[model samples]
Target chain A: AQTVTQSQPEMSVQEAETVTLSCTYDTSESDYYLFWYKQPPSRQMILVIRQEAYKQQNATENRFSVNFQKAAKSFSLKISDSQLGDAAMYFCASSAYSGAGSYQLTFGKGTKLSVIP
Target chain B: DAGVTQSPTHLIKTRGQQVTLRCSPKSGHDTVSWYQQALGQGPQFIFQYYEEEERQRGNFPDRFSGHQFPNYSSELNVNALLLGDSALYLCASSSHMRLDQETQYFGPGTRLLVL
Candidate 1:
């Protein structure tokens, strides 16, 4: 069974600043995918960024980027130029490649991020 | 593109009652998955439906079941509801062709309260 862990329960960042949220996982599969999702008060989960375990290069989506260390089993999210709209609960998740299982996501508890003005 | 959608924004049921939650997959998506998110907790996978069949399920008991329609819509049915069953139920959809990449879009979950 694969499990994701987000050590920080809460995080805050000043507007226009940068922040990093940490996440780790336990998985025996060599091929997998890692993802970060944001859920605002509207309760809608939105994809932030994703990283493939086989890709040594990190994944970057504009202001949202990921630092994926496969050997350390660590995948972290970095937010640059944070804005008030960036305030939300961030969750880290992992899933194995197709055929391994049902492709269900294993998510972390989540970290509530507060972007201060 | 009308990312996954779930019906009954909120529902309340008493103990031992049964409830059904509905979901419509995003346009062009053929697979639907259900998840349960408790307060202050992450969402847990309940089951996945593809081709109107349950392809994968979590640790949930038989009390939790689901069905997928020909149009790729799905329903989650829970019997003998318990207070512990109160949570936000989310529906996610993705394409089977892209299962390898696995990019699932989630809907605004349906909040279920069992009193």
Candidate 2:
């Protein structure tokens, strides 16, 4: 079974500062996908970033990036220039192929982020 | 374009009752996946439906069931609902034709509260 772990239950960052959320996953599949999702009070799960196991280059999207250490089985998300809008629950997830044309995601408990204005 | 959508944004039920939640996939997407998000926790996968059939499921019990229609929409039916079944149910959709095969986009989710 694929499992993802986020040890941090809560974290806070000053506005305009940066914060990092830690996540680790275990999977036997050599080729899999990692993702970070953000859910606000409104309850929508938004895609934050994505990383492929084969890619050595860390995945980044504007202010959001990931430090993916394949050997360590760690994928942590870093948010630069954190704004109040960044305050939300962040979840780390992994997807592994179950069968032909099918993939299921396993997610961590999540990290609650608060931005101090 | 309209994104993934779920109906009955909020529901209240009691133990031993049954509830059904619905979802409509995003445009051009044929696969739908369901998840259960407990309060203060991440979402757990329930199952996935494609081509009007169940293709994959997670570690949930048989009480949690789902069905996909010919139009690629889906419904999740929970029988004998337990207090633990109360959570935010999310629906995600992805297309096999996409380069990133598992790039699922999620809906706002339906919040179910069991008394």
What digit string (tens of lDDT, one per residue) describes model 2 on residues B8-53? 9999999999999999999999999999999888899999999999
Off by over 4 Å in 1: A98-101, B99-101
After superposing the true interface residues, what Cα RMSD does each candidate give?
Answer: 2.1, 0.8
Model number with the top lDDT: 2
Model 2 chain A worst lDDT window (10 residues): A96-105
Clashing pairs in 2: none
Relative to the unseen true structure, what is the C-alpha lDDT of residue A29 in candidate 1, on a scale of 0 to 100? Answer: 86
Candidate 1 all-Cα RMSD: 1.2
Docking class of 2: high
lDDT of 2 by residue, A1-117 (tens): 899999999999999999999999999998799999999999999999999999999999999999999999999999999999999999999998889789889999999999999
lDDT of 1 at A23: 100
- Which candidate wins on DockQ? 2
Sequence-dependent TM-score of model 2: 0.98
Q: Per-residue lDDT of A1-117 in model 1, one digit per residue for the tens?
A: 899999999999999999999999999888789999999999999999988898999999999999999889999999999999999999999988546345779999999999999
Clashing pairs in 1: none
